[model samples]
Target: MVTAKVETAGPLILVVGDVMIDRYIFGDTTRISPEAPVPVVRAGAEEIRAGGAANVAANVAALGVACRLLTICGDDGAAVELNGLMARQGVTLDCVTDKGQRTTEKIRLISGVQQIARIDHDCTVTDAARATLAARFEALLDGVGAVIFSDYAKGVLTALPELLAIAAQRGVATFVDPKPVDPARYRGAFLLKPNMAEFQALFGSCPPDRIVDRARSALDEMGLDHMLITRGAKGILLVSRDGEVVDRPTQALEVFDVTGAGDTIIAALVVGLVQGLSMATAIDQANIAASIAVSRRGTYVVTRGDLDERLYRREHFMTKLVPLAMLCDRIARARETGARVVFTNGCFDVLHAGHVRLLAEAKRQGDILIVGLNSDASVRRLKGAPRPVNALADRAEVISGLAAVDHVVVFEDDTPLALIQALRPDVLVKGGDYTPDSIVGADVVRQSGGRVMTVPLLPGRSTTATLGALGR
Candidate 1:
């Protein structure tokens, strides 16, 4: 689970291709319409999001990187809406408006999580518009670290050959999320990313085991340096001109919607490359970002905070079991990163459903959860002799393994007052029938402008009751 730190001060990223507005009309469908056989949707809310190349720029900005989008749109209402959305996301828009064209827009009517119907309005770019876009691309390619061509085959990317040639002359790396157009159009690109279906459409299908060989051959024919084929469930396959092949499995735990996943991947990959990460490491980060995007319902912009939490949980689980001093240091670092700290304490002698529920509730209160486990000596002083069947190390290990618990530290005192005073967590939590005033660290947490919460314990589930039932 080794990962690289993404530098926010990396060079600027330029995105050029088709830009469109994705409009979602959400509502409820209770009965069929009297007018027709279709379900009648009682529209409730409307959402407008950036799609196509504009979405790539949004994802890059969300990752704390500088990005600029270059595309052509119609002088219509959709163009105005696109401007406001991109401005809010911190993306610089360099758009050319053509009076004869109608900006591309996809209107999707959604009932609950299911999409009922979609309406599309689009227009192709004129030859004059392509000339203006080409000039803009050349001017913007001077200081760009990388360029992403997000082609939706809407006539915006018909001049890809000239654009790729200009980027190559300027020594700027270019990546392409290509549509199923002529293979020669993508020639000389640094990297080409196409889903499994697009890959088969452009360059006929072959046996699963021979994808790498076929990808390498395509690279040679297209004069490409590298190719990344994204297989939805099968994950991503990377093939280089030098015969280097790397296969990575999908990281998504659940699939909700895959919209804008390709935009997320290209955005993450180019950002990683600009931040000085290896190609393989960049692909790994892209996979993680794509996984986060698919778990969401629509065009989700994966933020830097989201990426940090996912990476931390994936790679730093074993490091969670630390001493009190190290735990304090980690809390300080977490605070610096704008993460809230949560604190809870207990003997946790026997792990049970009640304990799990309590911990999960505590985690919901804050970003980072720190469990204060009573030391062996402290447990004996509090629960009497022959109690705490699990040792301190064993207890910490088990708690740290749980997803709800971020870090575990053993406390020697009878109560966690000393630990609380030292850490000064943003939230203090306890399980049982206790008021905020009665909690041990309530005063300390309150003085620091923090809240104290209590979660009700599950009945008939306690270590003492289980020990008694076992006749111990």
Candidate 2:
């Protein structure tokens, strides 16, 4: 449903909550240690990433939205590393440094794909630091379109009620990834995102069928506008104050790790809302983003390009037969992400081994391979009457099913000059018989700084030869 690239010029998103560092020490375990009876890991790599609320902000920025994070941090080395990570992600940091506390950090020892142990250096904010954070929140609320509260119950969100009131007064929408503290503190927020377990912990347990009713009741009781309950493996459920409920199944095919998936959902949801999408549409996009997050290990940031590709695939899932206009739009979006587009046009009246080889080779030349099929009328004009062994629809469908073909567009012209001019693909490909200068539209492609090349045809395979053998 998201047809175009998200406009990044809209509003600023303010993320305020607990921030921490997630450090992973990856190694291979050979045998048990004599002293501790634990596997001795031979260290291979060490990686650090933003965690908690900082992760939420990173995901927001990764979507090309303007974001600023307001959190409390200690004046320690971890704080410095956290700042650097946020800066690299283009997240503006408005952190309150507390000299008396140590910055929170979670160090995980990973053996292969398994986590061996986790060590936590936890820190809580002081009243003085909370006051400072509140002041900073108010100062940054002027241009904020949405506020995200990523609470980890790390003592930073103790003043959530006051912060919610301030954002409410400014008429800015607030979203909360709530901790199981006091539900009343999240009142007046626009939406609250809680996983299945957290939902039961906050509001008393209820059957799956009655979740909507309970969520509606919770929404009314908390003075919230909506609630998103994430059910792992089951899907996401959206309950609004006006008795509208929408449930979307999880999009993940294989979930490698679910770390920071909730953050990805909230971040993408807010971004979608800021882009003027409906609540249901935003939730759908959020579901897609969560699927991408869980496919990777540890915390992951889903970018705009990643979402675009997933949406494109979903749209063309059944078949890659697309109209020229739609294909042009898709090409534009792909080009923005630095993807190379390869194009070749032919009748493809009879699918054969030679055609398959050519398509496969074309895909190897670029990231996306677009096949231009000549319409029946165009084939009649170019190859004479009764030349095509198949209709336009049949040929297009067969070509779209090939693994190397990313998209199939039917062009009416005898030559694909018009499509080539419109699409302006990065690479223009043809069969072996044609030279670079002899290929139709090669000049136009070359004028646009595109490459023109040809692939060698299979010696003994051809549609003409097959038709002759069939005595058609």
Candidate 3:
């Protein structure tokens, strides 16, 4: 599974839903009594944190995503606190209102050691709040990479159909962490994430073995591409056309409160997918996130420091996942000392021994060999109507791992002229009988007082040869 790599989460996320404030009342419990079976408590310090949609945004920001919040709040002190919370977390509040509606607030009463009860207060001005949030949503939809509907069923996500329709029209993926009370509201979302209890509440209880099947059928019936049912103690189940279920027996930890576990899962999943994680990998990260959430005292924000601490403690579990950018730079520097800068541009539609020998010879040239790769679009543009030996990412990854290669950078244009100009290699090498002038970066290298040369072409080793031989 692809673990979190710091720089992988720059994707823009537009979050629209119920934004609320969490007010925690803390006190000491010394004696039980006067009241029937209740302990007499001495009041202590109070605390306030972002809750509901605000909480989700906090989680998103914690993961280093550029998050924008769109929701309604009342012209009250709660709004003041919510605004302050967003600024501190580095999340921008775009769609907001200070109308007659009271901002949604979840007030919790806790004794020194445990939570006793919680109360929720908010504006019921559904019409005004809905209109304000929708206007902001429409305005923010133009450039956002993905949309998240934090449907707490608190009236903010009441207009779920419109939200889904808008995102669909824009070709943007939508993720919804919904309330079980109204499954119909979240239909047609790109993906829906619900905890086990919520899933059972909406789809009815099922034998543990058949739970995934039931969810798949329900997701299809609702027209969703997929569904991720978060099993609190059993782990996470991924349901889709390409289905996968990964189990995580609850991590060994003392459970404090599962207050914002759902919010935590949705936040982590959105960030992972934005950073390009596969469904299964994203689920692992989310499960890790939820594990940390449940271990905390209340609805707490998970920080990078906390994750690093986990990584240090659990060294056997995670390898040193260097960031991709860092890997490229490091390889480039190492090659400068003795490697030859043999570069070849191609769809590399396929990898073969010919390709390997070409790369190896390129490496044998001087100090470092850098390959300028054609992006999927660029490959399709140059290779013909329909051709890319492999997807761009897979191709780059495969090339980067080769022992003879130093770095592989993708360029979407028809040629790697710009990349050549940027890297400015000492020597430019290409395989096959093509002259130096035929190479895209030849001009740049020559202008920079560098040399360009063509390596001997290998016979019967071309991608075309392999494809025709295999009748591909």
Candidate 4:
């Protein structure tokens, strides 16, 4: 996995929209209510933190960046509490308020991990109050690297169009975590991120295969340069204006609570972008951050330390065969850390000393080693009807279990040409008596500035020789 690098000056992110005080009342549910058929929650502990756009800013700060929140609040106790929490998290808040308005607050009563009740106190601001908020937002854009529109459909984001226009005029890159209400309000945004449900609301239903084209259609109508649609456990897709689409799968995670996961995604994405990472790399990092977010309960925030630790752990183990998309993500992350990747392919119908030596030596040539195994059908076509004594799954499992193998991918074709072209590893290794120039994908590796290597075969030890001896 890639190591996340922190810049000394750290990018400054400006978040605009609604801010809220999220109040959690933890209690025990021990008895039924006397007056009604309901479980009684005996209050025990209470805690409050920033929510909505404030949470986005907190996430930005948690990632070791400077964050300023421009929002609307009320001259009330909740607003005061929100401000104090933001201060403690090192997030600057520039809010516009009027005594006549009520600060938005969500009070959730939880009995252990289950929420029993919730109380919402919210209000929208008048046109004059919104104008004041726009002015405050405009004043803070001087040193901002990117602007995030964290719209929660609360009163604070009523003037989204004006704010978007203002950011465009200043040539600032803008990211929006949109509400499902309307698509037109997000016109000219550099990136619009919506979860699957929200995306379905705006663009109707989309087949899994057609998501890219669907996103492109929406981007055209809204004048957005890019759209990132988050698909829960399915990962995210980035569709750009140039008709380029990158689909990144979600990191493997054990989910506990999904609250505030979206906020974490957008925060990491904008920060990575401003740090000069490619959009695909930024989205990969964000997906990793989001995976960490869902593994905990409540509104969890991921820090830079958390990211660094997880990535460091991933570099040390090989668990099982991964999907092609997931393998691509791993390769990209490895590349980010300047690690060389070595790839080899074969139909290992039987394991032998020759295979072992080739894999071990290939691994020695790079930091990562990937083995591409031919599928059952491909093996049948190449090695005849009864060639492969083992199934694809069994062969992949055996290959992945090796200490030298970091990843194993099965290809359906007789040759690994397409897979090699897509992955473009730093070195292509093969175990054979053939010369490097005679290798199947040697030219592909050479054209991409990578080397083609041929490891010497072990004397009298081959899969065919072993199988022939067993036949007797």
Candidate 5:
């Protein structure tokens, strides 16, 4: 398996599989019923999302990779909604139809932060439908960078071996999500990914001696090049004949629903590999992709922007500091993601002990703290005669360099009104000398329902005293 970051990365993956609808019934369970063992739920909201193969396509699309879907669905209401979801996702739906088969759907009954139960509706495809779907699959594979067979065994991949042969002869990189692993269903595949249960179930009786070896031999005999065993929470294991079996652990802090996680991993791996990433890099990318999937509430797919944002947020924050105007835009983005805002202002001339304490306290009031530094001219106007002990740009940049300050905006004219008007902070703070009611911008914030707090200036720790001590 490839170890880490590969030079080449990302590819167009064609996903062919079963399309299932994942429905969530969300509500509260208040009363214990005498009628049965289950608690009676007061239903609140019901949401439906794309699941199964459709979810994999969503994941591929979400990661900004090009993908196409080749599958079958019943001509019904679910199909209509599924098509809408696919169209919105920018994934091509070359999905064929079996007139009588019902599109698969998994209805999940959920209570606040918990799943009460899930019910599945699925059916096998008839021979005539399978032939038609196979023809459609072949026609759709012309320009695919990599091919993924997301066989949920929900009838999309009934003639598995023949499909594998077709995928192989075309030299398309393939990843097969094998289910009900009978070995016969997976023969001649390029890569086989079976969860531990499916792995053991298919080869359980063969030999207890070399469980992994036997599994590898079986895959090798079937003409498969690689095998990935997904051990939930233990992470993923990759087996390639040319290299070692590397086990990458599950990085999930908590697991909500296992639904659609595997689909995300294989889709990511296929994209990474076809895009020229090393195997290790591809799997790591897959691991990162899967880690993101399990944390989400439902079977909804994770978008590329989601993964990129998750991976790049810290870097983005460190590199994307902006001027005051642009800073408001950044702060707006932070608030949209639920970060609170704290504001404090000062000349901060000589970086006094009182300044540090005030900034730290301001930071404690909210998730992100913005320091409004008085411009040199503003400080001179406020303090009278050669006032600002430091230049405005230097002072503002120094205040921004602080660990406690999330951002810094400079204001002229002795007051922070303009900057305050821009940020509309959740909390505004000032030295204890003034009443919270009288602090500048206090009325603007209070009238807007934001809080205003007056903090005590640390005794004898003023910037003037520090400068006096420094000169001495």
Candidate 6:
């Protein structure tokens, strides 16, 4: 429960657990093998990548955060490849090489978007090796912002309690990507991220309705701060100790290979937490990152540039039309981040430069801008017949596509008074034509102790003028 924020130059993260090498042989499967009852995958290209905990570290480093990976591996050629991959990703490794142990490696034969077969090589460490790893882990925890345990049922994290104690002593956050063996060993962790199957396996199966209650009970029993249940297609569900349950739905993606999606989640989530982002915002970022990871083949690492482009596409353009209930839910989450909300409403039948200027100026007044769009029926009633050149859906889409607009809520009322009363935004903005007292929702905003302001509209730029010129 460390509330004080710890700032660092690199937002340094330390990952300790199992390390492995993932090799992929890609080609076409055209014929069946006569020798065996299987399709022959004619290998065309070969690729190597860091897997397991090492993949997590690669993701963290790729996102612009300096990462240090600590793990136990054997002195084999596979170990050399894993080390080389980690080094190329700019990850500093503190590896404990054991000559007697076997280096973990997984080779997959992929043919036309399908994994034909996989071969795995893994080994466990001896008691003496585990002791040596613990010593190295203790030395690496100094000045670290966060620690991630990427357990793969390997012996690297046998001393979980001691690891948690050391991280707690230093006031550093600790997160776990838990293995299926023993859930009790993960107690006292700041956050536990277990996928759906793993979560159900650790805790007995419960009905969907009772998941939150059962999860709360487990959190209290384990003394954990939070548990993030990652559902593959359903997205992530975060349950906090204070009985807060937040659900972030997955973004639409054409998933090619689901391998390493969990690793991307852990890397992006920990970075967001250490960077002081609210849980909601951090989860949003992680969801976006995971969406990108699943679209690629094999174990892929998501970079900061990829996230930046995705976020820009999400926020800057695209009409974000949401129902009233969903809008209120989003507003509540935004409020938790101490963001000031600015509300504005208009028909915006045909977009023009004046409307763009007004919306952009309104955005400058607050952290988030919510535009209340008048429905087609409401517009026809207010402006009479032959009005509303466009439908509600089209207008809402156009308004939402702007970079300045964060949310668009279509209302059927002539005035936005009822909607304003419900939202109670921090600031109510209007175009320059209206004075503060003349605004429709000014009184409702004032009664709520909110401010009312007007942004100057661009001269000689109006949708009405454009329509009039067309008639002339």
Task: Give the per-residue lDDT of model 3 (tens digit) for 1-472.
Answer: 1122223334788888787888998988888877588777677788899888888988889877888998877888989998999999999987456577688888888996678777989666558668777777877876577788887777777788888887787777888888847778777788888888889888889999898789888877888877888877777777874565555565525577787888888888888888878777777777777778888777877654444444433442332223334434544644543444555566677888878887887777666667777888888887775588578667766776687775566677898787777666777877766877788878888888788877777787888888789885
Q: Count the backbone clashes (under 3 Å) in each candidate.
A: 0, 0, 8, 0, 9, 0
Per-residue lDDT of candidate 2, residues 138-186 (tens digit): 8888767799999999989998999989988877888999985578888
What TM-score number comes out for model 1? 0.80
| Residue lDDT tens for model 4, 1-472 | 1122333466688999878888999999999989999999989988887788888899889887888988888888998898899898899888787667888999999999998988999876788888888888888888778899998888778778889899888777889999946888888888999999999898888788888889999888988889999999899989998877889888855788788889999998988887788888888889888988999667777777666555643553424566676678768866875899999999988988889889999999999998999999999999897979998877877887788998888899989998899899889999778799988889999999999989988899987888889989
lDDT of all the models against the reference? 0.88, 0.89, 0.75, 0.84, 0.77, 0.86
| Top candidate when judged by lDDT against the true structure | 2
Q: Where in model 1 is the C-alpha error above 4 Å?
A: 1-9, 317-349, 356-430, 440-456, 465-471
Off by over 4 Å in 2: 1-10, 24-42, 45-47, 107-119, 317-472
- Model with the higher TM-score, candidate 2 or 6: 2
Residue-wise C-alpha lDDT for candidate 5, range 288-356, written one tens digit per residue = 778878886888477655455445423444321245755776677678758889988878888877788
Worst 10 residues of 6 by lDDT: 2-11
Q: Which ten residues in a row have the lowest lDDT in candidate 2?
A: 1-10
Residue-by-residue lDDT tens digits, candidate 6, 132-175: 88888888877788999998986778888888888888788889
Task: Judging by TM-score, tell me the better candidate of 4 and 5.
Answer: 5
How well does candidate 6 score on lDDT at residue 450? 90
Clashing pairs in 6: none
Model 6 ranges off by over 4 Å:
8-10, 317-472
Worst 10 residues of 5 by lDDT: 1-10
What is the total number of backbone clashes in candidate 6? 0
How displaced is residue 176 in candidate 1, in Å?
Answer: 0.5
Give candidate 3's TM-score.
0.63
Which candidate would rank higher by lDDT, 5 or 6?
A: 6
TM-score of each: 0.80, 0.74, 0.63, 0.66, 0.71, 0.68
What clash pairs does model 1 have? none
Better of 3 and 4 by lDDT: 4
Q: Rank the candidates by lDDT, best first.
A: 2, 1, 6, 4, 5, 3
Cα deviation at 252, candidate 5, in Å, is 2.1
